[model samples]
Target: MPRHYVMCPPRHFAVDYAINPWMDPTVPVDPERAMRQWTELRDTYRRLGHQVEEVEPQPGLPDMVFAANSGTVVEGRVLGAKFATRERAAEAEHFRRWFLEHGFQDVTMPQETNEAEGDFAWTGRLLLAGTGFRTDPRAHAEAQEILGVPVISLRLVDPRYYHLDTALFVLSEADDEQPAQIAYYPDAFSPGSQRVLRRLFPDAVLADAADAECFGLNAVSDGRHVILPVEATALAEKVAARGYEPVFVDISELRKAGGGPKCCTMEIRK
Candidate 1:
């Protein structure tokens, strides 16, 4: 099925500050390489028959390229983001304006601190919300109210997988032809959360530490094609084995700031 996605070019992307475990300011980031990788990802989406929309990248906000944190949109309704850190506080307004200008009438800026899709994964039927890292626990309720979906709270245990998008992703949403599915790293979540996931998605693709560290779970799936990091070879095999085509893209430059394919792409469901 074709999907709509929003992406920001990595024109000014860099790991200037250490916010996540993957970010190392000392490590040099090649802006040109990042742009190449981002463009390839966007082009790949277009090739797959998905609609790709660009958000103008702003200067100084190095992490602005991780557009998935912008907001959560479902059925034409949007729940705007509220970053937990001051470094990314301004990104919320940029994304909010984009939604309004794009003719999204119901855009609500949340009072609670939530990194939007960075910590929220929509499963068609409900929302899987993450906390104990970037997003506040209260934001789960706010998302549930604004998006009008049942929100399941999952607590993150690892700093490396700070955002839910880094640790988990929806593989395919429930439709008349298939059931909702997901892929995730169990160790990234608390024991209870792990149990919840096990019960909810018994057939979910489970990634080992090696694949998770490679940002394997940070993937985007349009029900058929799963776009993921090229470094996650093992996870790609698993994804392919599940009858979904695994498309790889090397976003190593962007990974310097703790983002992968899913982190750079936000699915807009209408």
Candidate 2:
């Protein structure tokens, strides 16, 4: 397994909020809380024997686009992501420099509409792409062409959720003998999109729409490791039965801006 995942510390809403006006000023901005949450998140992964490397954050970018800060790692190559918004354009530069310093090669940048790293989802040979939020549809098509993988494009219905990760995550089996189980927010996808997903993975477990809104049905990592909000205990029980140990993190501050465990992480090179 490739080591090291990149993460940036939130600046306590001190940066310019022009990129995301939806951020409520009424929410108390506490750097200490932000630091504690970041540390807890990083430490959780570290406890699992993974190195958590911290990345320097750009001065004025929106925190919601943290998922777009870098591309991804594939067989030792670090692909750079092109940011769609002007606020995020500088992030790709940092991504390139970080990969080079770390001795990773084959850095390829997507050519279309500025790529958003979060748009790229790896499921075996199928690279599903979620478009219409920050990621453009054109980039999705180009990525499939370049990567030589079938790109399943899922349309984003809610801007608050932003990336597909906010609403969906794949929970693959630990061994080849077991079937792959996908956890996704049914409400997040359109009617046709839901049908497509069901056809693709007929055994996919449908996360309740209400639970999904609670960020309970998001990404569940490891065989028994799942990161979710503290409020999702009932949902946690359902997943626990599937052998997943739900790791609850208090994301109340982060949720004010509409994000949770899945939103905060970029599973690059996993």
Candidate 1 stretches with Cα past 4 Å from truth are: none
Residue-wise lDDT of candidate 1 within 152-213, one digit each (tens)?
99999999999999999999888777679999999999999999999999999999999999
Candidate 2: worst-modelled 10 consecutive residues by lDDT: 12-21
Candidate 2 per-residue lDDT, tens place, 69-111, comes to 3675544555578776785687778768876787765677877
lDDT of model 1 at position 210? 94
TM-score of 1: 0.98
Query: Cα RMSD to native, each candidate?
Result: 0.8, 2.8
Clashing pairs in 1: none
